[model samples]
Target: MGKILGIGLWVCIVTLGAVYGSIYLATAPAGPSEEDAKKAALELIRGEPITIPVIGGGDVTGYFLTRISFMMDKEKVKGQTLPTTELMTDQLFTLLVGNKMVDIGNVSSFDVNDFREKIKTEMNARLGEGMVDQVLIEQLDYVSKEAARKSADGGSRPMETTTVVEGEKLDEQPASSGH
Candidate 1:
């Protein structure tokens, strides 16, 4: 009985050790070194242009008002300037509009973060390196009479107030007069 118990204890110890070992290995950080990180940052920023389609439209031209660049550090950009610029051009906006426009109303509803992630993925693929950490939108605006009108009018114009309902239930009526 003692022998059996001893063997069982050993087996349990072995199993526990194996489990902990695997867990430690799996959760270990595999982040690149500073040098490799910098290299990746540079490579991502030096790749070809990537265009992403926008959604919704009227007879409007969309423009990226802010700088179309990703920062690795304060000094380094994630991708090359030309490609990044091209990615943020009116043409890219048009392509997005063409591909994604479900209705005119859907244009303003965009997930900025998702778009940035998409750009990052594309850039990484093109560069064959994971360098870009994020893409940021400096400014985004649409050039069109309608777009201007929408903005000026406070988004499709202020909705008119039809009526004001004061307190008191409409179900109860005042005492009726009987002659």
Candidate 2:
């Protein structure tokens, strides 16, 4: 009877310890940011902006220069025997190539925050679930194709010189010349 009592007490103590241990682990706080390597390792995939022609209405309308950075799952990426940088950059390039000038330049029509979220969603979809949680826009710029062409043809001038008159916008167009 004495031996049985001792065994029962040991079992109770073990069970209580397990319950408390589990609760502590379950309620523990999350680790550091994705860029931190001390608490939790993170991998940064960088992409530089490149000139890409924008095709619309069967014509090249403009060009886009875009750069993106993504925070990837460090553990998973390290485990794989693949070139993580190339993989991530290719995915980013694919996304940038798919956007139109209007999609990027019309910040007034489309909210910049919404566009950022859209980029995050698209990046995650390509990189895999939980692979990328953060997307940073390093650079994004647009230039009309015509502007580049004119500049190449020794024409240097600013486009869309505007003046305000009674809360109205007035855009001055370039004058045509004939010899």
Candidate 3:
């Protein structure tokens, strides 16, 4: 009888402990939840390379070769195709050719920040408010008519490729001769 009583006591104690543990856990405050810790998921969409002609003195002086990328809101773009190519090409032409944003002689005059903002703003305005998160420039380069002719004529002068990032200028690197 005593042994049976002790067994029952042990079972009761374990049952009470389990109940207390469950109650404590259930009543405890939750830590940072997934929703609270989560950030808006953004998707990166890379646009096709654009070539805009720089016309001056009634002639095509040089060509601006640019590749633009965009960061879009994942939720907003779900089940939808963005008209990025058409919009980007049009805006880039307006900025580069129409506005003369880039100076062929003074490449340092290019403002990448303003360029990015305008693109982002215009894209968001066209698509929808808060649809675009950011505008990224993958490539922004200028090839002069002289340089093109020189390379065509087999001149060995290295074709320089300029890399611009977030309004900071990187050193110009020599472009490979071959396509």
> What's the number of clashes in each of the models?
6, 0, 0
lDDT of 3 by residue, 75-140 (tens): 776644635556556665665675576766676777878878887887777678887788878777
Model 2 clash pairs are none
Best by lDDT: 3
1 versus 3: better TM-score goes to: 3
- Candidate 1 has its poorest 10 consecutive residues by lDDT at 161-170
Compute the lDDT for candidate 2.
0.59
User: What overall lDDT goes with each candidate model?
Assistant: 0.44, 0.59, 0.68
Candidates sorted by TM-score, best first: 3, 2, 1
**Candidate 1 lDDT score at position 161:** 20
TM-score of 1: 0.35
TM-score of each: 0.35, 0.55, 0.60
- Candidate 1 residues 1-179, lDDT tens each? 99999999999999999999999988957777887776554322222133333324453443222223443332323334444434434433543444542223454456666666765676556543544565544334333444545666788664322111111222222221111
Candidate 3: where are CA atoms >4 Å away? 1-40, 79-95, 161-179
Candidate 2: segments with Cα more than 4 A from true spot: 1-39, 101-106, 152-179
- Candidate with more favorable, higher TM-score: 2 or 3: 3
